[model samples]
Target chain A: MAKNLLDVRNLSIHYKIQGGWVYAVDDVSFTLEKGETMGLVGESGCGKTTTGYGITQLLASNAYLKEGSKVIFDGKDFVQMSTVPSKEYKGYRKIVEYHPEMREYRWKRISMIFQGAMNAFNPVFKVGDQIIEAIKAHEDVTDEEARKRVEELYKLVGIPVDRIDNYPHEYSGGMKQRAMIAMALALNPDLIIADEPTTALDVVTQDRILGEMAKLQKREKVAMILITHDVSVVAEMAHKIAVMYAGHLVETGTTRQVFKETAHPYMEALLAAFPNIKKEKKERLKAIPGSPPDLANPPKGCRFAPRCPYAKDICLEEEPPVVEVAPGHYSKCHFAEELYGELGGGESNE
Target chain B: MSEENNDVVIRVRNLKKYFELHAGMFKFWGEPIYVKAVDGIDFDIHKGEILGLVGESGCGKTTTGRLLTRLEDPTEGNILFEGEDIAKLKGKELKSYRRNVQMIFQDPYESLNPRFTVQKTVMEPLIIHGIGESYDERVEMVIKALEDAELRPAEEYLDRFPHELSGGQRQRVAIARALVLRPKFIVADEPVSMLDVSIRAGVMNLMLDLRDKYNIPFLFITHDIAVSRYMSDKMAVMYLGKIVEMADSDEIVFNPMHPYTKALISAVPVPDPDHKHGRVQIKGEIPSPINLPPGCRFWPRCPYAKKGICDVKEPPLVEVEPGHYVACHFAEQLAAGELETGEEAKEVIEESEKIES
Candidate 1:
């Protein structure tokens, strides 16, 4: 079997608050093969963004990764390299202290298409010059080479080459997002983390952009971790799926397995909540009763216990084990086996 | 259709609003240029019916909502509320008309005053309209409104400010404030777009419940077609400044006639992984409303547009079916699947294929 392009295990991230810590991400584990897309699906404040940022080590100052977390990319454990002492060096010396190598890895090997493309670019710089600067920063290329590359990228992303010389303000919202995608692919990175890349664009623009991106990802064979709250976008783009709740990964599986054989109640509710144009008309969406629990003081046991329709007393007393009901399909619930059996029967109880 | 339906609460005919764009510094120019935000739209909202206005940004859905609520004056056409033309109403008359109509803004965080407590926010409408004789009466009204909005134990939130409440709660407060006046018509502009998916259902259900209880007609404006279809009984698809299609929500979603409407529906991402829609991807971005095409506004990006007819003359909205209206010259042929897909659309489809290999 081919090696996994990215593997994250027991990844936990927390942000320091005034009084204590906000457990943003907890015990999340997933893997992605080259050219595969894994969607991190969740609501706001669910820590999906934190997990994406943690992969690139681009988290804010207040955020910290918990000990024992592992981010193994291409067989190299970044967590271990950043924290553990080097065996080849003298005593009490940590290898790659402060991650000076991370700067080289970032944008060169892994790039990010951030949310809200409006604020991602410098207002004063020409969009073409910005992409050229990114190319020049990563590779030993002359001005002409970088300019030619930027023009090629613009054509690849379906933006007219003439618009490349215009300022970011001169471009439309969709064009700005296409420019952001161009920059993320400027250096031919092995992996790209797109955080809600098409959230602000219209549905038509979003569909076009996602189509372009899927084609681009497949052609380049670059792995992707798509972080978004829109389930439909993920269902269309992602090969694998990970459903996140308050601060935990509630479910992970192939997109088909996750959608067709959903085991977790949170994932079920999320799918039911979204209004589908293809569904039968006038079906009232089942709304989860309460908001997500406060991260500073999350609920005991299963974090989604309060909102889960099938939650029982055991769900409140102890943390549910991550049960693998099917091959490569995992659900963090005490009743995963039972739910999987019922879901397999093609009848889901309300 | 007869205009004098007793059930209709609000009737708009040939409504147009043109925002003047000043060229240079001349006060009196040769000819004043207009943005033509909401140019000649017509629709009727019956009591308890939700007429969804769906379009992309700059498509003038919001402007139509504002015109209906009387927030902006129309340059042409009439907005008749309960048989009275409310377009020219001013001062005390307009203030009284406002009592029967209210608007719920898009952002709850920015819409509500930070300093005003829930009690004050809900009661201000009553105070302005002079609905209640005493402060105690207005307080009671406020509490009732809050309860109606599903903010259970309304007293708990009466003293709290907007900052203290959750986003959904703040929107509920905004709804409560709108309901305090018992308005005949409501203009909800993207009420649930800002909310999370789980919480969004609750707000949308709440609005549905309110409509059932009060029989208040609503002009629901949003860019999301699925949400619009779910919330509205009748749906209108807007392009630039005109209603390209109008029909029952299900008919419009399932059997759209207009090319633009078909493109919009096909563009929406379905949550089901196996669902593969026939891709009717349109080429290019939406044209600027300021410099709209002379003929059909959507002709430039339309997949089935003809060169001479579509570009030479504007198509008037005609009822292709009994209750379905479409503003396209080849609406009948398109609905029958006889019209060929334009070359540009085929090229766009080839260019946007997912994973060519």
Candidate 2:
């Protein structure tokens, strides 16, 4: 309804391999509102991480963007700058620096809390000094001012200020994660991309971290793109949910819509695959047959057709268009209505 | 199974493992600091039942698994396998015991050898145990193992290396290797934690199927309470280096009496958004195992701890409820709702303030 803070349209990212390009992320698009949380969830090699990395321009050397892709952030066409050439010198070949302005957006406007970020810190430096350096790198602040800000950020993330002086090894896994979250918030960024933020921690520590992040998100009003393979985590944290399989976004909707009125068969299978801790024991868990398709040489049509239980001949020959089952809910499936009808109703779900 | 007279497959009595640390330079200046990793633990695995050992990192769950498989010799106590003590087993007896008990590690990538093919990896266990008569017989055994692990069309995967397979495929190979010998008991330490959620259910179902088919008991160790609840029949909650509570899985999940168990259960994020978990936050960091706290090991961070009594003496594992064991001095009071939540620790603060005032 309101103007979206970040709009990614027709985004495709590929890696140049020996024979052909590895289509890591293909035709994936989603919008994130200001102060909203969107969860991008899938299994391994589902292009969930690549979508985040491509938006952040953190791809490796062998990777390159496909033609006709757009990433609009804060009313700016950031993806088009990749082809912008420098001024020609004496009618000769011109050098292209390739989106040097995008570097300025990093950490100041958009930042990331990486997976296994606790081990990413330098062991030699004190945690506070590292954060101080990060703060100084983005803004023209004095050493005294940066130090005070570092202390404040540490306290904001629920870490005791005194422990900020300790080295990374001195802190526990949970403390280091909290420290990473503090580092991501050092520059007051508008958006934070967290990839499996609490995967490595225990349940108790993960509970504390998720609770803290939720509190901080509400207080600071910073939009977040939480990427994880755990559906339960997304159910608790995000306002919207996007389900990806292979390199395709099979479904997208609000959290309630996706969880309650799921249309895509892949989404249904993925949901049933996870064992619910709160529910009673069933006779047997319904695990989806077969593995994810190979991204390097994925099949034509729908990527999930081979594993879809309700897939038909049309599903194998042509890819399904994005069909809006509800007002704001979309599923990339041909038989979405029939599937929903079979489930009885699209409005209520237990 | 009856409570008193059930046939136990593995009986662990007062198990202890203390790793002595050398602190000073040249190893001459300081007293040895013992990292009490698994200190005085006791439990029994019933025949054909899964005993889930749930704990956080550094809580000695993995160490307990390693000790059970004879990978690490216990410093004290007896590990009776089928009513026979295995601490003093040697040579042929130890080899035979190892054949009956196998271990499946967490990381599938690191567990299997890179150079070994799927066939070689599964066959190596059989070759070592001298199970089959000839090489031809071993090949048949390998194919059967792969099929039994649910890697159908086994011929297609025989030549593939670990790198060529997916995370779930590699884990199945690891399971195939573990099950090639048809072990009676297994110590699976977070087998599915390293896998993707979609494929995780398949592996869990395979494990349950194998357990039922082979009638094998498992010491399932994991930090995830949800996965443990799905897999294990009996659950044991561990903290620091001791079992804080042990009971039936459903009872432990529904009506947890121990404060630590309550905190752990409340910490687990349920998938449904409407499921509201009680907020029983256990504050502070777990104490370092190198120097454990006196009295109760959990006293430093326990919310329901009393001042004089809980800090003065450690409580033994008492059977407060039938078939439900708890190791806390105030287990009865806490279960009975007699003790306050200690939001401000009003009594403790008042008592300490009285001394100061």
Candidate 3:
């Protein structure tokens, strides 16, 4: 097999809170193939966004990658290479990760389209100027060549070519999203990290953008990491999915496996919480009770045990390993096999 | 649900709202060009039915809500509330109409003043209308309103500030404020859009419960089609400033007739992995409201816009099925949906596009 495009092994990220350190991404390990799409889904503050940041090394200065953590992207141990200090003026090793050199990998290797496209471009400059700047940053091309590329990208993402001179505010939300996509694809990157690209958009606009991305991904064969709360979006776009819970990788599997054969209760709870528009009349939705655990000091064993109905003594005492219950399917619950049987052909699901 | 019944609680016909933006200090007196936010959209919300107004951002969904609620008067249009033109209401009559037609804002965080206590927030509406005689009586009414919103053990929340409560709780306070006035109708503009995933469901359920208990009709404005499926009895899909399709929840979701409506439905992420709802990748963004293309507003984005008639004329919303309405010219040629793959996806989209033409 060819080398993986991205490999995250035993990667744990921590934030120094009032009470010690919060384990935001606890020993999460996953890999992406050359063209496959991996979806990371969870509720707010479940560490999916943090995992995306960890892959791009975009964590805050207070946050740190714990010892033995490794992020190997495109044959480079970026963590070690990124920690080179500039000088010892302050005596303490003021770690500098994601340096200016690392920026070469940021847009050229992996690009991101965050939730909102509001600040993605400067309001003062024309949208074409911004796209031109992005292209000129990585390419040794003249302004004319970059402008041609911008026009081509605008056409590629379905933005009218003539609208390039317009400022960012001139475009609608959907147009802005298309512009963001166009900017991200300016350099034919191997990986694209879209963090809630559709959350800010409505259904129809989101649909068009997702369809554009799907077509582009197939055309370019780029590996994508989609971070979102909407499970159904993942069902359509992703090949594999990893679910997070209070900084834990509780479940990981194919899209078919996770939604159909959900082994983790938190996964099941998430599915239950969402009211399907396709569902029939008079059916009441089951929203998950209580809030997520305090991230500053999470639970000892299973972080979700506090809200889980099936929690037992062992679950509260020891952390469950990510056990492969079936081929290409993984779950981090002690009662994984049992929950798999329980999730069989749910009522109102069909 | 009647096809010919015209029980108009709020009738907005040929409505228009235009913002005058300036370039610089010299341009302050310059001829301000209109944004044309809501340009001549006509709709009527029936008695006791939850009418959903849905569209994408900058498509005038919020503006339509504000116009109906009288929060902002239209530049031109007949806002007939209970057969009287509300746009022409005088001071006392306007206050009475305001009490009759209240509004619940999208962000509860902003809706409820952070400095005020929960009791004060719920009581402000009552105080405005001068319902109660004494402070004690008003406090009693405030606690009762909290109870009506299902903020149980009402005293616990009464003392709390907006920041002290969760997003769901703060929204409950907003609902209580709207409900305290005992309005017959309300304009809920993306009420649960800013809430958490788990908390959003609770707010929706609470709104539905309120609709049932109080018999309060709603003009629910949301970008989410699925939300219309949940809280609403009837839905009208908006594009630019026109209703492309309007019908019952089942008819709209399963048997959508407008091309825009079909695209909207297909884009919705169904939770089931086995369901094969294919997305229609429509070209171009929602056309600018200021300068909309002639004929159908959705024609520019319609996948079947290549058809001759779609580009020439706008189809009026006509009831094709027993209560299901569509606004597409080629409604008959479109086929019904089948399960999974094949022409099923195409049929689903074509049927809706038919209404748009």
Candidate 4:
């Protein structure tokens, strides 16, 4: 098997509130190979964004990782480096004691495309100068070389090079998003974490942007962790899929395997929630009933049991184990095996 | 157009709303530029029917809804509500007209007053319109409206503030407020876009139930085509302040005639991974509304736009098929697959196809 680019095991992060800790990301684990894309999809406050921030070690000041959490990147445990500084970690510890080697690793090996591009850019500075600053901050390049790279990035993201001198306010919504992507790819990082990149864009603009991002990811061999609530976008962009609900990974599998033979009830409900334009019959969407549980004091057993349609007494009484339904597919549910068996047997019914 | 039938609740004819843009230091003397927000759009909402106005952000769907609710005065046109022109109503007459037409704003958090309780929020509309005879009567009406909006045991939420409720619950309160007046027509602007996916269907179902129960016509404005298709009986595709296509929701989504509508429908990402969308990627961004193209507003970005006709003469919105309106010079040719995709659009698709492999 090809060496994994990133391997996260039992990663748990919690926010320190007034009374208790908010279990934002609880014991979530996943692996990503180089040039592969994994989509982290869930509704609001389901810890999808927190998971992305945990991987990058850019969590907020109030948030902290739990014990035994491991984020092994390129054969090195990044979580361990932060807690126990060694001789090789002295350079990182001197610069930032909290996040070891993050200054060197961030934007050099992994970059983030934020949710709101308008707020991400500096309104006072020109778009080109901001991207050039990003390039110059990481690499020891002169202003001329950074400017040339910015021009090339503009072309790559389908933005006009002449508009690089304009401020962020001057560009349209689509143009600003392209500039955000350009800045994320400024250093040619190995991985990109894009959180709702196309959520604010129009449908046509979003389609074009997703297409461009997919092409660039393939050409540059960059792994991505696309965090979104839209399942269709993940279906189109991601090779592997991870579904989250109430700070737990409900399901994780290949995109085709997960979507085709859905094991977890949350994943099934989520897929049914979206209105498909291609569906032959116009049927009412089966909306998942009730709201997500509070993370500060979540449910005892399955977090999704309160809203799940197939919840039984056992689901509420005991935590479900992660069962491997297929060779590489894992589902965190009590009836994952039974659901997978039924779905596999009746594949043609759908 | 038949007055005897009396089915059409709101008939908007040649509606135009142009916002003037002033530039430069001596802009008072200079020719003032206008952003043609709702430039001569015409549609009718029949009784109990939901006409969905779908488009991008600046495509004037919201402006049309605002005009229908009499929030914004149109520059020129006739707003015939039940065959009476309401374009210039004022004072008591405008207030009476507004009592029959209500608007549900997009953001429930911003629309509701922060200090007001749910009871006061929903009751203010009734008090303004003099809907009930007494305080007790108005409270009863508020409870009924809240119940109609799917907020079970409405009394439980009477004293709750906006912040106390969740996003979906806030939207439900907004819907109940709109319903308290029992208006003949309602304009819902992106009602469920801010809501979570899990509870969005419940809200949509509530609206559908309300429409059926009251037989009230609706003007549903949204950017998502799939949601519009599910909610609307008739759908209109707007681009650059004009209705590019108007047809039955299923017909328009399945067999779109206008190039812009085709591109819009095709652009919607379906949930199925195996289904391959017939990509009709339009080039470039929507042109600035202030300086719109001379002829067809979508010609600059349309994949099947012709040079001479689409650039020189604006095509009138004509019925190419039964009950289907299309505003394109080559609508028939494009529908027949006689016209080829533009060169630039083809190149863009080819360059962006590396991911499919």
* Strongest candidate by lDDT: 1
In the range B198-299, model 1's lDDT, one tens digit per residue, is 999999999999999989999999999989999999999998899999999999999999988988999899888887655557878887778889788888
lDDT tens digits, residue span B1-357, model 2: 225545799999889999888766726766767899998988889888999999999999999999999999899989989988997688899999999999999999999999999999999988888889999999899999999998889989899999999898999999999999989899999999998877899999999999999899999999989889999999999998899999999889988988899889988887666665544456787889998989999887788787898888999888899889999999998889898756554553453344323
Residue lDDT tens for model 2, A1-350: 23888999888777768887688888888999999999999998899999987787787765666656778888876677553322322211111234568778888899899999778799999998999998898799999999998888988888999997899999999999999999999999999999999998888889878877987888898999999998889988899999998988888999877887788888788777776677765445668888888788988888899988787898888988888888878888888766764542122224
Q: How much lDDT does candidate 1 score?
A: 0.88
lDDT of each: 0.88, 0.85, 0.80, 0.87
Cα lDDT of model 4 by residue, A46-144, tens digit: 999999977878877666777778888878777876644223322121112456476678888999999988789999999999999999988999999
- Candidate 3 runs further than 4 Å off: A18-20, A84-95, A98-101, A139-152, A160-166, A280-282, A344-348, B1-36, B39-47, B75-85, B303-314, B330-357
Q: Could you tell me the TM-score of candidate 3?
A: 0.88
Q: Model 4 in CAPRI terms: which quality?
A: medium
Candidate 2 TM-score restricted to chain A:
0.93
Tens-digit lDDT track of model 4 for B1-357:
223466889998899999977667536786778999999988888999999999999999999999998899999999999989999998999999998999998898899999999999999988888888999999999999999998989999999999999988999999999888889999999999998788788888889989999999999999999999999999999988999999999999999999888888888997766867655577888888988898898888887778988888999899888888999998888788898887887886775464456
lDDT of 1 by residue, A267-317 (tens): 888877888887764788778898999999999899999988898999998
DockQ of 2: 0.48
Q: TM-scores for chain A, candidates in order?
A: 0.93, 0.93, 0.93, 0.94
10 residues in a row with least lDDT, candidate 3 chain A: A85-94
Q: How much does candidate 4 score in TM-score?
A: 0.96
